[model samples]
Target: MKRDKISVVGFMGSGKTTIGLLLANFLNYFFYDLDEYIEKKEGKSIKDIFADYGEEHFRNLESFYLKELIEKHNKIVISTGGGIIKREINRKLLKEKTFVVFLDGSFEVFMNRLEGTEEKDKRPLMSLGKDELYNLWISRKPLYEEVATLKINVDSKTPYQIVREILDFYGKM
Candidate 1:
């Protein structure tokens, strides 16, 4: 329960990077957006990765980098890509190694958060259409639940409120 590494997992628009940055700043810990890290490591956008290689290759890179970060860092906050949970090994690693926070929110809420945002276009799976993405959420919801150490409903809460809630829980544990 007292994990130093906190990994935030959720749908694409679930504020993982934003909240993870705040949480890490508040705690004076290292913050890594896994996607950004991947982009830097591979020298290309994730969309390019998907287009050049494939989702399978991307997932492999995601999993490999995830493990590298987990093993190398202790006091850290990780904002994971939405599809990281698609792999069983990634799920197990997160569940066992980090204080995994599943930022729970409805599909509509997530879509609204991301709507009209330029960054939305950068996501490979965004091309799959709303219905498919919603189904992806449906299928992955339980996987997030299964790996979460603390599940935070992000629908109605402000970012500050969510951070406070996580800090409060961290303090208790």
Candidate 2:
């Protein structure tokens, strides 16, 4: 594969940021956590953005920044926000422009990963509680699978293991 961008996509708390940093470092590429980039660009937290402007507005901002990154960078590893796939434009970009790695983990896994963590608090969706978050995960799983160039079950792997898995597979490609 002609490696340009590798995007790690999954629900919140699936280790996208952790593994993305490792992947970028291993490959000597720039790393951009989409959420962090958006936060920095907006001069506020995502939690605050969702609180102040609501989901629709947040989604628009998400789509805009996503396009900017896709267009502006090639040698990059982007850890996209969970809700990014909600937009068809974003999905098309991922499917066409980048090698997407779907971190496939069950709802239980996701819940366990985020429970009582700072990630759980920062995510506006998680504040809706388990049922809502689970539903969101369920809905997005197929979308992630649809765009994924590779899917790795993340139930029991350490960040290092997952990063190695990605690197090994990407190298072969």
Candidate 3:
């Protein structure tokens, strides 16, 4: 299949946003971060949305935004939120519109990257501590794998390296 767009999904702190931007730039395509899109549309940060309306409401908005974005863009790179794979509808839309790349990473690396950050405020799932976080990752891993067309281990890679790997793997480099 000829890929016109690419969707990057992974756990929080897996560098989806960073690598998505790099990949978009590398391919000369537009870049969209789903969380940022939601924030812009709602006139509120994701942290505030989660605080006031809760995760379910936030996810609804995210789905809406993602659908709109997919319809509007042709050549683009999207960095989806960590929990995007939870919804089967989201997975279906992604599969139809783009090649989904799962950024696979270790729980220890994720913990190290997320350390000292206020991610819990913006990402509700990260509120759980190390053990709980690891468990959550374990549970979500299968869902990510199920929808992924490509999987890349990002535990010890730089953003540029990951982008290079994605391009190479996709035969776009």
lDDT of 1: 0.95
Q: Backbone clash tally for model 2?
A: 1
Ordered list by lDDT, greatest first? 1, 2, 3
Q: Which number leads on lDDT?
A: 1
Error of 1 at 126 (Å): 0.7
> What's the TM-score of each model vs. the native?
0.98, 0.96, 0.93
lDDT of 1 by residue, 20-53 (tens): 9999999999999999999999999999999999
Worst 10 residues of 1 by lDDT: 1-10
Better of 1 and 2 by TM-score: 1
RMSD of 2: 1.1
Question: Candidate 3 local accuracy as lDDT?
Answer: 0.88
Per-residue lDDT of candidate 3, residues 39-121 (tens digit): 99899999889989998998899899999999988899999999998899998888778889999989888778877877645
The C-alpha stretches of model 3 lying farther than 4 A from their native spots are 118-121
Tens digit per residue, CA lDDT, model 2, 85-153: 998989998999899999888888878888788888898887686787778888899999999999999
Candidate 1: count the clashes. Answer: 0
lDDT of each: 0.95, 0.90, 0.88
